[model samples]
Target chain A: MTIWQRLRHTLRHGPAPLPAAAPSAETAAALAARLDAAAQRRLGRSLAIRHVGAGGCDGCELELRALNGIVYDLERFGLRFVTSPRHADILLATGPLTRTMAEALARTHAAMGEPKWVVAVGDCAIDGGVFKGSYACLGGITTLPVDLVIRGCPPTPWQVLEGLRALIEANATPAR
Target chain B: MSAAAAIIRAGAASGQRPWPRHALSRERWQAMAAALDAADAPSLQGVWAEAERVHALFLDAGSPLAASVEVDGGSYPALSPHCPAASWFERMIHDLFGHTAEGGRDARGWLDHGAWATAAPLGPRQAALPPRVGAPEPPEFLPVEGEDLNQIGLGPVAGAIAEPAHLRLTAQGETLVRLEVRLGYAHKGTLGLMRGTPPRAAARFAARLSGSATVAHGLAYAHAVEAALGVAPPPRAVALRAVMAELERIRAHLDAAAAILAEAGAAFLETRFGWHREAMHEAAGRAFGHRLMMDAVAPGGLATDLAADGAAAIRAALAALAAELPDLVRRLDRSASLGAGIGRIAPDLALRFGASGPVGRASRRASGHGGDARLVPGYPPYPVLGLDVPTRAEGDVAARLRVRLDELPESARLLRALLEALPDGTIATALPAASGEGLGVAESSRGTVWHWVRIEGGLVAAAFARDPDWLHWPLLEAAMRNGMLADLPLCAASFGLTSSGVDL
Candidate 1:
């Protein structure tokens, strides 16, 4: 199990294959259908997302990590999380919006180009979830206009992927 | 004896027994802090405020006993001047409760960002007011000295999959001179929200305090409440709690390994470790109902039970992990290029911060402060089965990584022991809504996590949960001193400090 052995094994086996747990063709097409004709034309097939953790408990962060792993492999669906909001078509936000992060969230969303969409990703983001009346949190992201809401204390990776696919379809270019 | 233990012995030697509600004059409180610093107690556990007084909680690394000192007023002389370990705790007390540590060194806001509706949100009659009055002023950070040092602020919004923390690094060329971490971006008013809520419901806030260590926090919160009510969970519940806790520990270590590997640029190894962690989560989900096992460890007992089928599945998962981990570790260790920049931490710096968990263990291996929650007296199942603790003396990134790898098999062994001897009985006991105070401690994946609670009239009056990061984060600055800037990520990842854990 040494590095030499690992290199040997890599030489013998080659690189690992792309993950097999991709979204079904029907699911992809349906997601594409959700996009309006004009929006879809503008966005095309690829979607870049910028994630902002407003004031979360870290459950959603863990789930988001899972989506990138081999089990979910979110990149296969033409969706990728970019580091900068300017490079993103969607802002995928998690957590109850703490007042401290409200300005930052707004700035991030504002940085996204025109036709940018904001998707609230967890129960906390959709409303307040358990953190609902805390003085620290403003419940959801009240500072920005939100387009999509995905609810769960922390939605599972599959659920997160489904939400992403839906966002793509909703903004996808319509067929002729 | 260790310095901390000696301090406790000497402090208590006068024979005036200091109980839970031990009152001290301002002078006595200041003198005690100075004495403990001179005697070298590990860290101040927490500093909190009640109706009209401020209290400081202290723990000796070598003993289970906790000492509390109360001074009547909104301010007391700060302990940070002599004992650097109490620095953040004092600032936090000032921020949250408006209690001043009169002569504390750091005056920066530890939790408050001026975004709140009011100053001192937890101060007398302040909770009812909204936390936002107008626009918040930008937070201030201390500037690093020297003309050569250039500052870089990393986050509050990071690239991906990270809790919100502003890591302000002061580097001279490519060498780091200082690392100042600003948290509270994820502070959800957890303690404030817990007040007035019944223990059963307030337990969720504890679990959510840091999702990665949910079971430990949940169990600790439960223990605090049970202690206050003067009740012990049924034997079956205690055993079941142990199962969930151990499983959590295993999963967290796997995740930490994956993070460390990713930082080391071992892409394939990182993914493999992450996959292993995912398998553990899947098994946990099948057995319990949540991936993080959230809400499963509730006050008084478990929220659910582990069925026979679930037990078998968990056993199979552990077997798979046990079989796959060694090969992975051996491959990771033998990679020569990855060994060059593994960060190094000094034992004295770690001791000064009262570091715990893997970070502390790797610093001074023979120190025997392993952050074992099972070490706390009166905890069941663990004492009988015993703990298989691991330590590495190098105090470098590689040493910390090795400590985690060593723990994987040890945790697996603990899980197997618990599963084989599954106790049969009621999984939960009803807790009465009563008034009292208690401290609950648990060894989470990160390290020893403690929750202190005071319940009154069937509602939580006050609560404090300490993440081991409180000790480790300060030490990180020292660890990074004069080290290459490129090694910062790996060093931070190796420590596995959490923002929400401390920010809360």
Candidate 2:
């Protein structure tokens, strides 16, 4: 596929969808275009991020690692996964937020500085997809007003890209 | 004693205690923990107190005949039990729930340093408070102080591809005397998240707590549910679960081996081992759902059967990994830095703690469920295939790595055998008509991973899963003593600690 075609394709479908999966190809394409835009905008800026989960299958977290893999290279975008809340800008939360992790999540979220966007990735984060309102987890974006939601148990790398794509776009144009 | 006999005997040793290791519900576990307060044995992981019941696991390692005990610490400050291994877990429990052990050693808290003001909790029920403005400042952790030695602080902010741990090293110049640790910077509060999810779906949550050892955690979680519900998995499923476990074991050990090689500074040899592990993971991704093999097992059986071609692919992958291990071993042997400073660390302390996995095996404690016990239920097939294996006596970093490297081929051999004898039967059993509680133990790549489950009206009431990281973290702190600051990451990564897995 040509680069333009690839970008268009990503903007629509997100990433390569699985056999009979629910997400649309165009959505994947759009998500991809967005992810690209997010990274492109932050070419030289240093960003610190922390991943939090209400509760999840953990597939979402693993996919986040791909951001560091040879292909995506989150570091190239100057994105760093920091251990201390002292050095984080964006708090990336996944999972459904089990009762066990509720305090930890709140504790972590509270520790971050202002200008922080809480990105709730995956279906679990969007609305407790697989683990819907289980006693352990309430639901993401609902429990804590989520800034952005990427829908998928584990959103695809490009959707993660696109969601991130949407992230920077939102940052560029503040909500009315 | 045989593993089962040993278990029964171990249970008998603590017969005098009021909690007696067999409580099933959150209330019972909490009551048992409260009862054991003065009886010795105290430290908790994941304090979950809800209408369902309250549950947490207390670790007591001072007496090995009764190595560690899991208790339910409920209302009323319970009596305390603190072995060095329980250090990380206790801090975590205090951070989550208001629960506190009355007089445990090292009562200095972990996560709940008044960092967050919203009731400092893990909850399904809350006051529905609006998002408060004016952020609360995180409390500074109490730094260790002493005149006898200088304190060294290691990473809360560390290098990428590394987990965060703060090690306070006390030493006189270079010769180390003591190492105190401030853990839980990576606390995710996962256990608190499991409150209402059905036992089946919650099993997936456990599997991902750590990136590696996915199979063991899944199996343990599933087994806990199965036990609590009085369910038994299909025989074929049991065999399959065991197969996946050994597959995970082989891969985890391979990863550790590669790290050891890298730590020993043998880039040439390390790269080869690293590639071998990568190749193994690729095969796993093909055979299992994901490379880390997350959520592949459930209470009834496996999430899905490994397809015929997938098994064939895995068998081939195992063969490939086994083929390269011998050469990898020879290269690792040539690495001049194998035992960087083995002299200073106390080999005796690691043994005394009842350390499990390669760490224990290296220290002269006969371990490795497959090689040492002969009763590692799932090895007739898959990575451990028909084989003659052996353990070593060095009990140091090098020895542990060697055990893992040696175990890799054996796991491959077992995987090959499993493929050769693939059975035709249901992959999962019907859920049993069980209620109350039951426990399950699976020897993970690290060591024995335990899961305690509580069920009521066919719903999960409470479940506590413990990883060997809880048992080994303090020992790692102990090992850091006498070793220079440079060896911190190398020593830690060599052990391949799993923070989240141990946290809950």
Candidate 3:
């Protein structure tokens, strides 16, 4: 297909109007400040991330992996994914929340330490993309509080990197 | 031609205290228990609960054939033998339906820990309760430990990635001693999702269970429904299914090749492989309507048939891939670092686990189950065309890569063959509703994926989809021994085991 055709396809199937794209919560300057501070004290902001499967085709996982690859390189910013909920600084949930996994999600979120962030990545993670409730879905990460939502059936690697960058940026910002 | 006869002979050779195939229900179940008691079958392959009964398939150590036994749900809660693999499925049956395998030990549940109001899933003729939130108390994860073994835990989260599973790897200074895997972080009750979703809709759900094996799941689900209804898919549909399977195979192999490069630290090679995989996915999306082929196949036929333009595009993409893969593999073979980075394990491990797909093939096991034999009902036109079976002897991770490398070209060749002769006929029209229990199996890229479905008067009674992961996960544990800790990721990538596929 030609480039124009590809663009048209995206226009036709792309996610619902971005809902104002959730205005950036923090500026680059603030993000830089926190990074420098973390570096100075030798105590970088520790992020214990939780991966939630709301309802998705795992393409989100692949793109998310791409962001962590050598190309996008997420570790450089000192953010890391964690196993235990008690240790989490962010719950990086995916998929559209299903009825069965709902309790696990709620408990996992409640288990996280203070100053938590929930970022829903992917169209399904945001609003149950391809699997919009035939029988199993309860809907997106909104089943719980979501600090950020990235849209796309499975967002691109760049978008994944951007969303994480926003989370760190937002964390450093003073609540308005 | 006689799957039943082949199974009986293979069973006796495997030393299963054999029961004649025509034995009645009680007679067969009792005989199977006796065989297991006699240590004739070393492993219980799997079990499925349909209607009010549960059937168990068993195989003796190194046996080529398998035997099955069916017992009353009430009787089962007490009579089944203590086979490890059978344990999970039994517990699953109990959790969903309320039936127990008699004398089944541990009694610990799989995932349904009294979370739902419904009775055990298979015990009830129809579903009773609404979806529930939590299993009673989460089962205590069996902590893995030994003298002075440093434990490094990975996942549930490692970054922004969405794959969910908490892996506890116990090792002594990077040499892994034990791997206790905790799966189901993403288990959304997909099997449960299939309970009544018309097979057409259910196939879509199955397709999404694992992104990589979408086509496999789609075909397997379709096949189960087809068999349940006893309707053979059309000739064109069969031809198309083969083409799609081959396409899925080559695409996955390309991804595996790229992953091998990534593990070997060959940056350029890795990128080349990644691009190829993307190109394949794109081509697939254009041809089959879903990049992953989700919802393509339906009961007795196809939901969507291949269009001429789509077929032409797929052929073109395949031609390009076929041309490029040779040079790419040649580079990998010549790279000393990559060759050294391949798995260093023994073939014995792969054998012990009965690993399937490229892993089994690399360990020198037959990779392809003769397709023509599986087309028993002649639904797909597979009997008309043959498939290439890839094999290797090293059984190491590198051997797995080599198997994939060889298979990649073969898949492309298959694509060309299928496309050149793409049949012109109805994909499928319809079939009568299933009147009894039936079994359906598809040769997925990984290996044979089976779906056992029971239809009672036209509605789905139960659907049990089991992928090759049953054999794959165990082999992964076997492969990890004696490798350096960093190499663990490389090892896993080489195998690319899917937890979602396994958990279901």
lDDT of 3 by residue, A1-176 (tens): 33355358769987211222332555445544554554422223445566665435566665565454444455666666665778767788787665456776788788887756678887777777655653445667766766567786566655666667665654555433
lDDT of 1 by residue, B1-504 (tens): 544344344443211111243455566666666765554554565556655666555655444445444434666778788778788888888788777788888988878888877878887746664656666667788856689779999988875667888988888999888888888888889999999999999999999988889999998788888878787788888988888988888888888988888888888888888877888888898888888899998888999898658788789889878777778877776784563445677676666666667887787745555455576443677888888778777788888887888988888888888888887889888888778887777778887787888888888999889887888888787788888898898888898888887888
Q: Which has the higher lDDT value, candidate number 1 or candidate number 3?
A: 1
In order, the Cα lDDT scores of the candidates are 0.78, 0.57, 0.62
DockQ of the two-chain complex in candidate 1: 0.62
Error of 1 at A157 (Å): 0.7
Q: What is the model-wide C-alpha lDDT for candidate 3?
A: 0.62
Candidate 2, B272-294: lDDT as tens digits: 55555555566666776566666
What would the C-alpha RMSD of candidate 2 be, to one decimal place? 9.0
How many clashes in candidate 2? 62
Model 1 per-residue lDDT tens digits across residues A1-176: 44466569879986543344444456555445544433444577699889999988889988898788766677878888899888988898999998788878888888889877778889999888999999889998777877677788789887788777766655553565
TM for every model, in the order presented, reads 0.92, 0.70, 0.75
- Model 2 misplaced stretches (Cα beyond 4 Å): A1-176, B1-82, B87-97, B113-157, B163-178, B340-347, B366-390
Candidate 3: TM-score of chain A is: 0.70
Every candidate's CA RMSD: 3.5, 9.0, 8.3
